[model samples]
Target: MESIVSELEGTLVKDSDPFSYYMLVAFEASGIIRFALLLMLWPVTRLLDACGMGDCGLKLTIFVATAGLRVSEIESVARAVLPKFYMDDIDMEAWRVFSSCDKRVVVTKTPRVMVERFVKEHLRADEVIGSELVHDRQLVRPLPVIFHDGRLVKRPTPSTAILILLWIPFGITLAIIRIAIGVMLPMWAVPKLSRLFGGKVIVKGKPPPPTSGSGVLFVCTHRTLMDPVVLSSVLQRKIPAIKSELSNGDLVVCPEGTTCREPFLLRFSALFAELTDRIVPVAMNYRVGFFHATTARGWKGLDPIFFFMNPRPVYEVTFLNQLPHEATCSSGKSPHDVANYVQRILAATLGFECTNFTRKDKYRVLAGNDGIVSYTSSVGRIKKLVTGFKKVVSTFKPFIQ
Candidate 1:
């Protein structure tokens, strides 16, 4: 069998900038605290790299990013998030040659776990030789990463890193102020008050008047966590619009179940279609300069914080005609048919492409797990951490003795 030996990073990827991937692992696996620690140590890493000790710098970064994270958590990021970024950075010329070979081996100085999955899965390498994450050993995609979680949209190069380092303090203050305004003021008063802080909500197309008897189901295109909030601000009505529940007042549901940043609609779940025949399709979109309002891999609690932190965030809400009695599930249309019909209507209104991809597909590609949020009690997590720490301490005791 013809075998080929190759290197990763510069050899396979067009750009060798590893900071962004490291930033991702730091932010997704751990949290902002870890991410800040890594960013603070960037100067040290750069200094070490400049002194011709790049491997030392790499090791330092790996420890900062991966420390305290579970093996599974790190693996989740590698499997879901990193692959997309790596695939985007692949050097076409290098890939052409690498793929032509029958057997493939990849080598790199990066921690083996980081590159091994990307190498074997996407690059189809037979073996990866690289630096082991813990010991010393050996190491490693072109897939459009459609979904990813993080506040930062741009890759964290040295310059970007510096900007983020400077922005955090200001961002937090801005987020708090923005959140306070939303909380303190009424929905009708919010849009007006928001402008003082660089928030803008543009309303278009007259919203259908609220139906009198049965509750109306507002089917909205999911753009950000703020979709419903923004929609509510424009609505000006105080009628209760809860998620999933069909109230006598009104109900709001995003059938996509997850946010899609791009101008494409994930498959609409059919449950909303069967909820009620009184359906109103809502098209929503938003723009932000420095931060996004949605994530697939990171702590979702921060979605609104990052959203409100944007210096000038703009949201546009368009309301379309209500679904007629003939077009709803109540009129003998299958639930799936009604769902697809609403999806197409919203996609058309927003100029987005309708896709059959659902929430599971999004999370599977971006987070390496199902999109469901699992709750592990804080006590449970503390116990797990203590157990793992004891194992590590015991393992090193032999060397110390």
Candidate 2:
């Protein structure tokens, strides 16, 4: 197979006449016949349903004739009509213009011998889709498979038959499982979890006067996927923009009131800063990275649509005051270390009393230093420790010394 591929690669011509280009397009198109037939079957079925029995039969006959005509007659017509497609001999001026353009170009030819050679030698395109040709001596014979990376990659396979044998039943099973999960899970679970983690509130830099709309930005840390969810639940409003793919259901579990548009997410942070004081920018401080992981610049080029979106203001939150090395503290200690550490920082910086205590009645271990626990465990321990410290401090009266 490798030797056959190498022989084929060696025969690839640097230039081709018009006849070769048409053959390539036809060869590539033949590989998709089965998939195309399957897709056509649905519309054909619908047509059959709408028509009388005689009409339905006629429609099926027409479909067969149309497909047959394409296979038998289209090639000669296409070859005669298509201009002599040549890429290797493209003038230097044309090459300069083509190279400067940001958009991708599709080069089509019947057999595409010249296009394939040009692609192999010069174009490092994201993708290439073209037909194949078999050559014996000087004669070109169109092949069933398209050549990619010097390999006959695409072949005429019974795609519909394979889909029926494998994919259809699997797809149905998947749909059933998806429906079960979607129906069983509570929609409120996200909000409830967010509220449990100190329901999102506008972290004010300074107390503001009584105003109907305050431009509030919530700057938080980003560590886990749950961070954004928790913050959104606390805020009770959607983050203005999200990744465009997420908007299109690429990312499941869209936040309530949160609509993600790639363009909007890319720029809204800065635009919001300019438009209204009510704009709230929420960011997370990860202990590892010195800055918030999500930033205006980071969002650029991530989505095609983001380039056109309005810019919004972004505020950074350095919640974890200490660096990661400082936060690691003594290992082999109880999880209580986490509680104590958090409490100390809050008390020192925010002037809030934070403590660690065991929730004996709940039969839960509250705090210890082992970091290798679930997020739930860490949150439970932190809450217990902070609550306990606050209680202890409330009861103490500083004696005049």
- Candidate of highest TM-score: 1
lDDT of 1 by residue, 140-238 (tens): 233344565556666666677677768878888988887777766666677788898899988888887766556788898999867766766677654
Model 1 weakest lDDT span, ten residues long? 392-401
TM-score, structure 1 vs. true: 0.76
lDDT of 2 at 39: 42
lDDT of each: 0.74, 0.29
| Clashes (N, CA, C under 3 Å) per candidate | 6, 42
lDDT of 1 at 301: 58
Summarize candidate 2's per-residue lDDT along 1-401 as a digit string, tens digits.
01112111212223322323323233323333533453445455456656755446334533432344454233322221111223223454444444454432334332343343333334322223445442222112221111111001112123423433353354344434432332343434533432332222234333222223323333222222234433433343333223332232211121111221111111111221222222122333222111111211112212111111111112223233322333332334333343344334433443323222222211121122234463356456546654553443232112100
Report the number of the highest-lDDT candidate.
Answer: 1
What lDDT does model 1 reach? 0.74
Error of 1 at 381 (Å): 11
TM-score to true structure, per model: 0.76, 0.22
Cα displacement (angstroms), candidate 1, residue 354, comes to: 4.3
